[model samples]
Target: MPITDEIKKTLTDPTPLYALAGAGDLAYEKLREVPGKVEALAADRQGAQEMATAKLHEAQGLLAGAPAKVTEAVTALPTDLKVLQERAQGFALQQVARAVELAVRAKETYDELAERGKVVVDKARPQADSTQADAAQAVEPSDAAEPVAEPADPAEPIEAELLDEPPAPKKSKPRKSAPGVTE
Candidate 1:
């Protein structure tokens, strides 16, 4: 095909036009979210400015007291570092404890699932074996011809023969008398 024909075919196809319209709709949805995003950013900027001002005031107060506390802080440095180290160790220990607890819970879950799986397999195994046996019997040829049993429908009730007696016959409807005759 010529390049001009190919270009004409592409322009005439409705799929590309539908895709453009979809893209336009998506862009419109995104544009609609812009105002909310702008408002959230403005609020965040205000919050950050307030936090910075508070930190600046706190720093100024600390600076005012620095000279008087310098010697005391210097003397307490080793104790402060030891306390920080103990806290870090405590946090690490807590994390380890949580990991152990999670492992124990996972083990319990695995064991429960394994037990349930075993029960399910055990229950299904007999039914599967019986079906296999039935299939095998069907495939085997016998010297004597025996009637093949039809698959029993569980919805139909099984008729059991009564001891030394046959089943009662089904009842028939009584004959209607003639219109003028009295029975």
Candidate 2:
């Protein structure tokens, strides 16, 4: 059959004809929708361009003013630092003075407590001495009343146990089963 005749026959077939017609109608509807879509996109593009241009102007303004502001801040830095240093020094001096005052108060309290301790020790010395003498006297009575036992040989029992008890378990060293083994 000739290709043109076959093509014509296929085009005339009712199922294919209906499908082609539907596709063409869809294409036409899409084409009709394009202008409105393009218009909306262009409007959006214009708004973005305007926002970018405004930001660029703002950036340019900041850049233009930056040098003078930087110079002013730099010129003021030393004086600002000096003022800050003076404040810090004043605070340091106050802290040192407060610390010294606290130390003096602590010293006075410590001295007072030490003096009180000395007085207490002085008051208790005679009593402590008398108690020691009384303990010694009481010990004298026991020394005379009982016969003293001879002191045990401290190492004898330990030596005897050492001779009798079984030896302690020995620690075994780890063995490498293979040459490449690691702990």
Tell me each candidate's TM-score. 0.35, 0.31
Model 1, global lDDT: 0.77
lDDT of 1 by residue, 66-135 (tens): 9879988877676677888998999999999999999999777555555555555567779999999999
lDDT of each: 0.77, 0.76
Q: Across residues 70-93, which tens digit of lDDT does each residue of candidate 2 receive?
A: 999988776677888999999999
Clashing residue pairs for model 2: none
- Each prediction's number of clashing residue pairs: 0, 0
Worst 10 residues of 2 by lDDT: 15-24
